[model samples]
Target: MFSFSRSPYMTALFSFGVFLLFIFLQNTVIYTSLQTVFSTGGLCACKKCVMDLNDDDWFFMRFNPTVPALLNRRNSAMRSDVFTWWKGLQSDPKKANFSDVVDVLFSLFPDEEHHVVTDPNRCRTCAVVGNSGNILGSHYGQLIDSHNFVIRINKGPTKGYETDVGSKTTHRIMYPESAVDLDNSTHLVLLPFKIKDMLWLISVFTTKHVTSTYTRVRPSINAVREKVMIIHPAFIKYVYESWLRKHGSYPSTGFITLIFALHICDQVSVFGFGAKRDGNWHHYFDNSLAHFSRGLHRGDYESRTIHELLLMDKIALHKGV
Candidate 1:
C-alpha cells in the first residue's frame, strides 16, 4: 500500500466536488418532482386526486346527493317527484310507460350500473368537444385525440374537419333530433328528455319504427348496441336544478355532457363551446349561424355558468382562436 499525504488543496478540491455532486442530485430531484406535477395536471398522483366537491364553496353549496350520474336497470325507475320534474323538461309530459320503455332499452343494451368506473390510481382525462365554429381553424384535432376520452356532442362531424375536430370519438352525446350514426367503437350516449326519446333509441336498433321526434331522426343508427348509454333523468334534473338553477327549459346537451365528464373523468378539458371571435354562434362543420337565444336553452346563462366553472378551476376551457 502506498502511503499518500492528503494535502490541504486536495482536500479542498474533494470537498468542492462533493458539494457539486450534492447540488446536482438535489436539482435532479426537483426537476423530477416538477415533471411529475406538470404531467399529472398539477397533482402529485392523479389516482389519489379526487374531485374535491367542497374545494369551491360555491360549487359545494349546490352539490346534490340525490342526483346520480348514470342510469342502469337498478336505478332506472324515477321517483314520483323526479318523474314530475324530468318529464316537464320536454313538451311530452304525458306519461307514456316510462318503465316499459326503459325495460326494453336495457334489454337491448348493457344494464350496468355505471358506464365509467373511477380508479384510485388512474387518471382519466377527457376532452369534451363542442361543435362551435370557434374551433373551425384551431387545429385542435391532435390535442383532442391525446385525451383518454374524446366526447363529441350532437351531429358534429369529424370526417372533413379532422384537423380541428379530431377523428377519435369515445362518446357521442345526442338526443333523437340531433342523432347521428356512430362507428362500432363509439358509445352512443342518449340524453333522453322524454320517454319517446328512449323509445326511439330502442327502435333505432330493433324495429326502426320511430322515424322522427321534433325533427327527422335516422330510423336506424349505425352504432354499437352494447356500448349504448342513457343519461339518467335524475341526473338531468340535478344538472338543471343544481348546476343551471333551473335556467332555460333544461340543461343543454353540451352542458350536460360537461357535467357528465366531471363525474367520470379525472381531468376535463372543454373545446368549441362558446361563440367565435366575431361573437357569432355556428357549427364548425356548417356555415349556418346558430341562434342560441332562439333555442330552448338559455345560452347566456349557460355561458356564464361555464365561465364560473372555469374561474373555479373545475374544468379547463380551450376557447379556440
Candidate 2:
C-alpha cells in the first residue's frame, strides 16, 4: 500500500545504512574472536608467538643463569648445577655412599652434543599422559598415538587398557622405585629422588651391584642404554621455585613431566591431569585408591597452575573423560 520514490538522495541514504550495518557485523565478529582468544589463555589465533617463546632455547636463556638450569647431556653448566642440586638435597654421605656414587652417576652420561631433533620440518607434538582415573573411559588411545611423542609417567600401563590409554610410549618417566620394564625404542627417563636412585639406574644397565636404595629396586631393567636419559636435579628445583612458586617442598613427577614436555616439544597436550569438580584423585588403572595427598606436593595449587595455563593457552589440558 505504500511505496517510496526512487530518488537519487533516497537511494544514497539506503546504501549508506547498508554499509554501516556491514561494518558493525564485521566488528562484532572480530570482537567475538578476540574474546575467545583472551578467555582461553590470551593466545593469538593466527600465530602462537607465545608458544614460540617457550622453546628450549628460551628455557636455556631464561633459567640458565638462575637456579635449576635446564639439563641436557651436553651443557657443562647444567651438569654442574645438577651435581650441586643433588649434593644439597641428598642426606649426609655417612647415611649413604654418595661420595663414590657421583662418580658412577657421571659415567653413565657420556660427553656428547645432544639435540632433540635433526630435521628442520620436525614439528614435535607431544602428549603428556597422566594416571588419573578420569581417563578410564576416555578412549583416548587412538588420539594419543597420533602424537609424535607420547610420554607416560611412573607405572601408567597400556597393556590391557589399550582401548582407553594408548599403547604408544616414546618416553617413560620413573624413579628407581617406580621403574617399569620399557621397550627398546622407548626412552627411559630416570627421575632420581636421591643419590641411591641414580645408582639404581646405573646398576640396572651394567651390574646389579648398587641394589638397595630407600627401598629395593629391580636388579636390572630391559631398556636400551642409548635411550636412557636422566632428569636433572636442577631442573626439578627450577620447577619448584619458578613454576609451582614453592607451593610444596617439591613438585610432583607428573607436574615436572608436563614442564619437561614444554621445553622439548613444539606442541604439548596433557591428558588425565587433576580431578573432577567433586575432587577425587585416583589412578585410571585402579579405582580403589583416592585422594592425592597435599603434604608432599600442593596438589590443589598445582591444579590451579594447570588451569591458569589452560586459560592462558600455554598448554592444552584434556581434564575429563
TM-score, each model? 0.82, 0.74
User: What lDDT does each candidate get?
Assistant: 0.81, 0.71
The candidate scoring highest on TM-score is 1
User: Per-residue CA lDDT of candidate 1, range 1-321, in tens?
Assistant: 432355777778888999999998985675555345434334323632325553545765454434677788888777899998887776774366888777787889988966355344577789999989999889999999999999999999999999988899999999889888899889999998888898888888888998877667788878998899888999998888788888788888999999888777777899999999998999888889988865678988889988988887878899997
Q: Give the TM-score of candidate 1.
A: 0.82
Q: Which regions of candidate 1 deviate over 4 angstroms?
A: 1-44, 47-50, 93-95, 293-295
Residue-wise C-alpha lDDT for candidate 2, range 64-173, written one tens digit per residue: 22232233433424466556665666462534565455556556754343334323345567899999988888888899999988999999999998888889999999
TM-score result, candidate 2: 0.74
Task: Name the candidate that leads on lDDT.
Answer: 1
Q: What is candidate 2's local distance difference test score?
A: 0.71
